[model samples]
Target: MGDVLRRRRPSRAVAPLRRDPRASGRFQRSHRRLDLRQGCVGRRAALLRWALAEMQRAFLGVDCGTQSTKVVLRDPATAAVIAVGRAPHELIERDDGTREQDPAWWIDALRGAVRDAVRGERFDIGGIGVAGQQHGLVCLDRGDRPVRAAKLWNDTTTARECADLTRKLGGDRRVLELTGNLLLPGYTAPKIAWLASHEPEAYARTVRMCLPHDYLNLWLTGEFLTEAGDASGTAYFDVRARRWCEAVLAAIDATRDWTRALPRLAPPLSVVGMLRREAAESLGLEAGIPVSAGGGDNMCAAIGCDLVVEGPAAVSLGTSGTVFAYRAEPAVDPLGEAAAFCDSTGGWLPLAATLNCTSATEWVRELFAMDHAEVDAAMASGGAAGLAFLPYLSGERTPNRPEAAGVFVGVRPSHGRDAIVRAVVEGVTFGLAYALDALRRAGVAPTEVTLIGGGSASDAWAQLCADVFDLPVARPAIVEAAASGAARQAQWAVEQTRPSLAPVTSRRFEPRPRRDLREAADRMAALREMAGANRL
Candidate 1:
């Protein structure tokens, strides 16, 4: 873990520390009183040091993602990334449709990422924020330790529980009215319902239930609190009102008292608490640094891309693909295809998520024993070649088919490996296009699209997204939007002002009209219908 952190160092040196013009006025006014006190030479020196440190402080942002924990250190004023580090954690997958991770692994990964990010650097950290994968259920007992493995968002063992909750709530539409979302197997409420029915002993022992980011926040600040963005994904939260809905909780058999199990709600940009002594010591940082109430990964990514204002939508193509847009008012989809979520900036986020993305491309790359560059070359030359594929390697979410499996249609012997790989890539892009259409149906019309996540690193993939979505796609200079957004939240918490740094677009891909894509779209529609009819 330590080795993971030490592997990457910033290519450029940070600018020398200087007095911040923004803080000079306040510092001068406060210093006048320090000089007037009698026998205060030591106190004056300490105060001066503290004031100077504040002028040159750097902010730390930790992103506890599904595969790894990433840390980024940046200048709050300029938003220039000074250093970065990451550490990977293992994911437990089961044949019985279970996905779980130990909370302890997250803590260890965060420690490594922080240690590596700040190695040989001595800038005072002004504030810290964390963003994590949403919808994960972290259960704690009276001792504040996890009673069982944390259930992740991809875990699908709660299908029966989802059906039961929907029935108890009267129907899917009624559930959507109460919670702004339909009962889904990936949601926290269904997971809790499953736990109560299957593992009654653990449910009885549970004293608290929180998301992954909330657990990390508790370790840092010793306060159990969550903000609107992540809380809205819990399925028990009322998105329109921005609070927990007792009716939704009752539907899951968690009564009014279950609200106590949830963390206190905090404003997204507010400081939840100062870093605790133990956490500071473990990460080699000073105690009392302000920690902001961070948000879910999607919310933070929106911030990282400067999607606080409308007109630009963000499409993240990671293990899962999501299309999200900022909205001034809650945009509830009556059919429940789009999730009505809250943004970290006190706005609404209407998003549609698909279960598969780069995971499909990765599968093809591994099958051919090729590196990314090799795959890119093959895709550039192979084209679609009339081959079609459904990239539902791990089932699906947007179309609501949990039992569906991957399918390859229109394949011929002459198509070979390269053509199949290209088909896989196109299939994933088509899946994202379906999500984009859902957002459009919900009345989100973005002037431009921001493509992000691990897949955005490939120019070929970015072009494919632009061509398929039929919109100009821009990739920001910084690829780690989630961590960058978390840092911006930290800056906002410490300064009491929104960070003014605009995301710099390093490259933009314009949509190109292709006759072949039109035919491919038809094939995709037909294939989707076939899969729906033959769902396993």
Candidate 2:
């Protein structure tokens, strides 16, 4: 079978779920010339025209992902994406766990993306919502330009700083009490501390600090502001209070004037400001377009998955996997097992973020020198590895300490690369399931799962998730849910007063019987526990 056919041999339910005549015709017409593989979404007419007329007239959503920046023109009335555009981005790094990016490059990429998206279009793009890789700190000079490269979420250069912050803030208990999370090198506070102590001059010049998405919002509207969703990731914000905690700031003895450098907080859906004429001209957009206060990638992904209202949580497996459970009230973990934050939709989300996921799979594939063809072949051969692996190569993030790295135990020479590959896949799935368990413990038992991210492209991976999680995953008809999500946010932002602008379809995944699921779960639990014990 060809890759597409083999992968898309839809489940039995898919046949019955095929669109009725009217919807199918509309889809075909709206998406007439676009190919799915090349990121052709939002090209359909009813969807497109509705968006342009009602949504795109006022809002634009831009997502600055790890690999690309996607821009969408949306219609607020229908909450559809009229047009979409993307630009590439690269991650810089070193062996010492340093990953960074230039803030200027991010801006240029976004500008280029917006220009491409609206090149021939005539809609008046208004409120812009920017979403980007979370946990990255963008420090700025007094004039609001970057003083140095941003320290990304994946960068581990602040490990020592994380430890120092944990110690200074009265250990894990106190850290969780105040920040809703313990010190991790990936969060904002440790990065700030790392800069303050190591590069005082850069820190001194840093009049304000912003997360990656917030920084882009500043450039778009020339306003200093951020939403609660992004703010909670910074160790400085109090999850319970939903604002910056002065006590935490006092504990770190950060410069008394430091907080003033940051933008005033904006509600997630709040309209921050309109585009400046210069920004508009650079991006081929109209001046005075409204820009909504957007959110972190995870929050936006949840919105894309329709997890904003309620019901089963969504699982996003990109390079990293995040299991987000939404709640109307904040849920804190004093034990620091999960990271809880504010959702962009004025709710709380209990997040289980383990570094292991699609990244581990990619790393293992590369380590074995196996290309996409090899991985596909192995899966087609019913590849099953009796072996179990711990995919914490970059350290575990959720339900385990960030310092915990990946391990493949019980590797026998008899174990082939295929077995290793299967083990890696199962490992990440089980890790995510572990997070779901955490959510259940917190009294939010999800009834369904919305599977998303680039990793969702793989049939084998989705099947594995369904089997391991023992729950059907909702694979939406369209991919690029993040970009679509940003576009939807644009729709909502422009309307301002509308209720429930998101469109929904009845699509779902059902669990396939897997005899080995229970065994695999048991083994993964033992491995995680053993790893935890060794750390102490």
Candidate 3:
């Protein structure tokens, strides 16, 4: 019994490090006993020197989303990400069709992300910038303290207010003409109207209304400001003029008691302010570190995906789907087919955002009891699902129709989960194509679309984008393109100079022949037409 628990001891044992100066260090002592390890210390010291040089020029980028906040530390010279960290936060859904989160929760999550990113040691951390969820309204009092939880973009409580705005603003035509978008519940105007009518006290206390990214920027730098892309989402920004819309503000006054709610416009790449002392300490960063007023999540992602050039767009299939086409100048459709948002690159970008993309696929997958990989393979098989899906699991944004519900037409008993899943994927892709067609109708066709997001990770899905969009779709190896875009903004803020946009390394997926894609897309168009007619 004693032998069973006893451990065997070697004839000689070597301890690790010795602090005594008289005694040789562990490596040296061990080396003297073994001659082959002599030069390793010098080599390690040289590598450490190189590493420090690389770290000195690194920039920090943070992306705040609905579910989590991601912090990325990148090396500017090589454009390589050195450190990545994420902090998860909670999302609360009220029974009243309202979705919101404590503004403090986002702040705390951001702090934790930064702290975790720079833990254990000091980092140069040249600059810091944020790319956060857009269209979410955060009200702040005169003291710059949050008055209440942030009303997220998905919140449907503002639906009635949004409808009122469309009517008061002279229908969708006036909204598109002034704000470069159709009236939507996700915009700041509707949210403000809802608060003014329902939460009058809170609305009266509000001194300034800011987007999510702006709120984080305020905490980091004590500055109240917003980036161009985010400002564009507020339904009060003049895309061509690059300023706040005075007309929209006045229009709201007639319908809602929003006398105090207004947002100031700032360029997406504008330098907001330096990091505050408390923020600096928490992030393990030096005080006064440059913090750029980064743009909305999608716009920053466009920058991250390197979609600065005209023609080529970036397609993000996140919780929501978006096809963002970079333009050298402002582009607005009178028909309200697409939105003209301010790009982080200091220009205008026309965007078409679908309320749901991957979220739609996930719903169908769960409903059918099929895993992602299995469904993805079937979709890539190029077999027709004999079905068409509208992919409106939530609702619609671009094209400005929310009543458009998800549809699974042409379903038959022979079809299985694979066919249904393929239809969902194809349906979302077709929705994207519909937006692309709008871009083309406006006389601006994308040369290519850079696919970035969770959907792009799957080869089958990437091929599907290529097939459905009928153009080359590029994907990047970098997972956090949005965070990288923020890092790029930070790098520009601190460098005392701006760098020219250069194409970064990325993989391309050229369109391949697909007979089924055309058929599926045509079916989707017909279904969309029927749905549109039903709404009318």
Q: Which whole-number lDDT from 0 to 100 does residue 33 have in model 3?
A: 40
For each candidate, the alpha-carbon lDDT, in order, equals 0.85, 0.74, 0.76
**Cα lDDT tens digits for candidate 1, 1-536:** 54554354332213233456677765665556556653466477556566555445688888999999999987876788888988888899987778899998999899888877877566667889899999999999987899999999888788899898888889988988887888788889999999999999999899999999999999999998999999999999999999998997877774537768889899988999998988877777778888999999999999888898889889998988989999998888777878889999899999888888887889899998999998888777846889999988877878776667789988787898889889999999999898887777777888889999999999988998888899999999984789889988988988999856887899999999988988999999888888889842
Off by over 4 Å in 1: 1-56, 254-256
RMSD of model 2, in Å?
11.2
Model 2, span 1-536: residue lDDT tens: 12222232211100011246667765675455444422446445335445445532535677897767888766666666677777777779786777899987787778667656765556655467777788999999878889999998877778788787778778888888877777777788888888988899998888888999988888878888888888888878888888987766766555457568666888776678887777766665557777778888888877766777657877888878888878888877656666778888789887877776878888888999998768756654553556888887776667645567677777888888898888888888888998888777655778878888777767777777777788877776543566656656665766665355444643565787766677778888898888888742
Cα deviation in Å at residue 51, candidate 2? 17
Q: In candidate 3, what are the lDDT values of residues 45-131, reduced to their tens digit?
A: 455555565544568899999878999888887777878877888988865667798888877677667656665444676778799
Error (Å) of candidate 3 at residue 163 is 2.5
Candidate 1: residue 175 lDDT (0-100)? 86
TM-score of each model, in listed order:
0.91, 0.84, 0.85
- Cand. 3 TM to true fold: 0.85
List runs of model 2 lying over 4 Å from the truth. 1-58, 367-377, 380-383, 501-507
What would you estimate as the lDDT of candidate 2? 0.74
Please tell me which predicted candidate would have the highest TM-score against the true structure: 1
Query: RMSD for each model, in Å, please?
Result: 5.0, 11.2, 9.4
